[model samples]
Target: MFHVFCLGFLCCSMVFGILLPVYESYKAVKTKDVRQYLRWMMYWIVFGLFMCAETFTDIFLGFWFPFYYEIKVAAVFWLLSPTTKGSSFLYRKFVHPAFEKREPEIDEMISQTKERGYNTIVNFGSRSVAYATQVILQTAVKCLKT
Candidate 1:
């Protein structure tokens, strides 16, 4: 029924949006052409943002929009179309400009996150080792008593 259409739409989107683009990106990388590589990199950045937005839209508004899948498929096709260069257009118009404006703030946030993540991991590791040692010691003592 409706679910079948959604599944088909997603499959088509995946083929055009992800799989084919990935192959093209690989070829672009192998050729060592900066222009082609940059083009595909733009596509990847735009596609990533598209996916994040789509996840929320699909969760909140998908059922309400009867033509959702069709529109999604068309959008993916547009993004991948060489003639349109939609991905490049979007990156230049939106993503690049926004990121450029916020790059410093973004970098600061990333640096703080990395520091916190490292500290958290170190803390977790030490706690885990301590717990394991305690458990082992307790088990050994119990076994010896028996």
Candidate 2:
């Protein structure tokens, strides 16, 4: 019962908090606006209702719907949830160009990446991890010898 409620809570939060924002970001790219609206408010209401469904499902039916209830139902509730395509499209089309706003830093990073590549960063991080692990092992071995 409580488990069902908890799952429902997770679903609602995922839908509202994570999914909605991502969707809005996508819409912003497609529509070129980041303004909040009736859609967001409606989703908030839907999340509340879904939470209620989770809490009372057991009471009503001795069964759990548990928020993966149905795509049709969720779609009806969500009424065209935001998709990621718009966002990626927006990033390539709009954002990449706007990073001109960070000209010097972007140029420096690109130059370093062209010169040294990702392997340099990865090799440095890996070397640090390996050195730390060896130091820890050597310390343990010394303590045992003592």
Candidate 3:
């Protein structure tokens, strides 16, 4: 039971960390919000962290057995579904959703970019392989040259 849950959790983490970011980048390009992809990726990281914490605690508390841990999974999933890193996990899930308050989704970001103009930007994906690999290769080559 735990194994299955763990598998699902692992998949979610991979999607949020990797697949989702790539998708966000595509979304940003399509929406003409060059920086919004990075922002969305940041939100994914925040959500992944929250899911890890909540699920970890529930598993730690020994509350994830017999009933298949639906409550814990649902609680964590719903909490992390929002697109914001502003609120803490618990508040964002158990509280924020109640008020129908949404974190900035990629669509909202694209809209903002359309309405206004791009001024401030964040590289949210500087650590991405495509971005980081060039520097890594350069450093390796420099060391070889030395």
Candidate 4:
């Protein structure tokens, strides 16, 4: 019984994860349609995040509760169905708003970091090399004394 369920799950995952995406990618390439490609890309990214959240939810809440499986089924259906607009809802309500609010702050931080990051990395690398060389020379000196 468990094996049957596992097999079915594997099949479904393979179809959805590999076959469908490959088909869509081929279509996107053949048609040279940027919108179609972007739409699918956005859908997958949203769905991937949704799946991650769902996994954590299942781990924390699923074992103690009944009807979790049913809820997951419904949730998957909602996410996959274009009419439900689950991906769009998630992006507009959560992803877009959060990024929009932080965009200026994020851009400023990136610019500031870019200015300092090269010098920081060079300083750190040179310090690390100097320390390593000092340790090696000290070890060699100790070996000579012994």
Best-performing candidate as measured by lDDT: 1
**Higher-scoring candidate on TM-score, 1 or 2:** 1
> Tens digits of per-residue lDDT for model 1 on 15-131?
999999999999999999899998999999999999999999999878898788889899998888999999999999999999999999999999999999999999999999999
Off by over 4 Å in 4: 1-19, 83-85, 106-124
Q: Sort every candidate by TM-score, greatest first.
A: 1, 4, 3, 2
Q: Candidate 4 residues 30-142, lDDT tens each? A: 89899767656656767788678877885786666566655655655565556886756777788778878999999999999997998899999999999999999999999
TM-score per prediction, in order, is 0.95, 0.28, 0.35, 0.61
What is the per-residue lDDT of model 2 for residues 114-140, given as tens digits with 9 covering 90 to 100?
778777888899999999999999999
Stretches off by above 4 angstroms in model 1 are: none
Best candidate, TM-score: 1
Query: What alpha-carbon RMSD in Å does predicted model 2 have with respect to the real structure?
Result: 14.0
TM-score of 2: 0.28
> Each prediction's Cα lDDT score?
0.93, 0.58, 0.58, 0.72
Cα shift from native, residue 55, model 3 (Å): 7.6
